[model samples]
Target: MTSVPRRTLNEAVTRFWSLAAPAYDFSALQRWAYRPPQDEVITLLRDHKCRRIVDVACGTGILADRIQRELKTEQVYGVDMSDGMLRQAMARSGDVQWLRAPAEKLPFDDGALDAVVTTSAFHFFDQAAALREFRRVLEPGGIAAVATLAPHQPPLLSRFIDSSRSLAHNPAPDEMRALFTDAGFEVADQHRVRRPLWTRMFTDRITVGVRSA
Candidate 1:
């Protein structure tokens, strides 16, 4: 498959989300659809006792809110490029530090974060650059969780994938693993989990890695 140009992909994603922002909060379909799997991801982080977390590509702060509530850490921060999405996220309850920044170039010091988590946003990123940035921001032995829609998934997810065909750039699982490994993160766990497709079609794959100390 031919790779999409970075400038074109970024522009498309920004425009799509910017226009979708107004209707975004009203999309109860997104909440019920994504909550279960997001909860599962949070559980995984809890199991690892992750705090001082950075939620990369954190659209609307769903995962960031959960991390703050569940972990009760003041260290929660979120980064995204879309101002519209970031505005919606800031409106959400919790003191999450939201930054308008791209995942490919995080605005944090090297080895500053304890854990990093991203949900449903990997496919929109420049994966290699984003993974390298994740490595740069994470402290030694810090955990990183990157989740996105799996390829050839159920119809529910396939619809979103198709709708965003202009913007979606999902890499195969092995390719994702290689990106992380090449960035100095050891692939600790990688797998798919099933969840109810409540609204807006929910199907996802999660990858967890640790920065080598």
Candidate 2:
């Protein structure tokens, strides 16, 4: 697939969330496609005792809010590229540290976070840079969990998703594993979880990796 110019793509994404901000929550687009299996992902973080957690691409701050609610004492940060989305997130979840930032260039100190969670947002990121940045911010032995739509899909539906104008490329299992390894992370786990989407089964996947010391 051909790449869209970086600036243009960023602008388009920003405008998209800006325009969709108000109706983002109510829209099926958010619930049907964008949301991930966050309940289980949050369980993973809690089970691992991750304290400093950041939810990358935390649209409207759902997962971040849930994380804050579940682990009351932990620090939960939400980062997104659109100010509009961050605004909504801040309004909904006042305690979360909502920042306007890109995934590839996070604004955090090196080895500062205990865990990094990306829910349904990895496919939209510049995968290579995102993996490197994730490794950069996480502490040694830090856990990283990425919950996203399945890469392998039914043929026609897969084409529909791939051809979608706003969507990005999805990496197959092997590619995702390789990305984590190349980013200096140890691939610890990979699995699938079923999410209900409009009465249909969305067999999403998750990959957990650890940043080596």
Candidate 3:
């Protein structure tokens, strides 16, 4: 079977989100399905006391906006590959420096941020390259919190699920921790999180790692 070209796959994802940006915030998936995981990410970042933070693949800037409000800091930034998404994000907040950039290539300087976060979108990233960039842009001892889907049980079934998506890949929980470790971060915490009384439609494994100091 022929594989989809990398560029083609990326462009498709961008186009899809660009079109989805207009009503993304109002989507049930965003309002209901993903709320629990997003909340968990917010709590983790707050607990770490991150003052300077960036949210990657921050569609419509919902999470970034919340972070800015929670931290009461003006150093928050939101980045997404979709221009349409950034436009929507810009309307949401003036404090966050909204930028259009891919996960593998951030606009921040080395050791510039206290925390790097990307929730509900890690499966769409080139995990290795993105993690490396996350580490590169974070100060030593900074936190990297990534919340996303993971492959389910049964080794062969997990492999099948990952292979089913040509443009997206969901790593197993252990594999995600290993990826963070390989990217020069110390695996700090890794677990599945869900809001109480919420449907299990989108439970995500959140992995927190600290850049080696």
Candidate 4:
């Protein structure tokens, strides 16, 4: 996946989201697996005193809604590569600005945002590019809080999940922490958490990186 088929991949992603849009918020299992971690991640952002923020790859703006309602963040923007996803997001949270854009190319100016947050979408990103873009948009002392599936579990479980994963990579907590440090954010926190889907448990990581003040 070194040389990603950008156009082809983008089309596929868009098509997938478009189909998923109608029932995205209504799915019980999807909400169970993703929403719990989202609550914790939003708490992490607020604890860092993040004022202005962008939720990159913000699918349906669920986190954006929470950022506004919980953090009372002055300016919250949501960015995603798929228009269909953004459309659903815009509909759900009309006040927040929803942009259909890739994470590797954000619209914000250098050092323009106080914090950049993303969830469930990191592994699908071009890692270096996306991290660079994150660093580029963050202000000094800014934070980037990412919540995603962690590659940690029983060996057989990890192998099977990795094989079925659609993204380029699913990094362990250490790998993600180092990636943040390398991208100019000073690593502040990294830990694993779990969300349950009825009988199954899903492991995840919440990694926070802060730019030097």
Q: Top model by TM-score, which number?
A: 3
Candidate 4 similarity to native, TM-score = 0.88
Whole-model lDDT, candidate 4? 0.79
All candidates: CA RMSD (Å) = 2.6, 2.5, 3.2, 2.7
- The TM-scores of all predictions, comma-separated, are 0.88, 0.89, 0.90, 0.88
Please identify model 3 stretches exceeding 4 Å from their true place: 1-3, 153-165
Candidates 1 and 3: which is better by TM-score?
A: 3
Per-residue accuracy of model 4 over 1-213 as CA lDDT, tens digit each: 445576666667778877777777886845776787788778877778887899998888898988988887779999998777888888888778888888889999999998898888887787778888998998888888888777655565466445554434678777887788888889888876555556245677888888765
Which scores higher on lDDT, 2 or 4? 2
* lDDT scores in order: 0.80, 0.82, 0.85, 0.79
What TM-score does candidate 3 reach?
Answer: 0.90
Residue pairs in collision within model 2 = none
The residue pairs found clashing in candidate 4 are none
Which candidate, 1 or 2, would have the higher lDDT against the true structure?
Answer: 2
Which tens-of-lDDT digit does each residue in 1-213 have in candidate 3?
027765776798899999988878876767675677779878888788889999999999999999998878779999999988999999999989898889999999999999999988898788899999999999999999998876663454345346664457778888998899999999988988765555553446899999997
Which tens-of-lDDT digit does each residue in 1-213 have in candidate 1?
Answer: 126778777777877787777776565656665665577778987898877889988878778887898888888998888888888899995589999888889999999998888887887888888898999999999988887776665665666664555456676789889989998999998887557544424456788899997
Q: What clash count goes with each model?
A: 0, 0, 0, 0
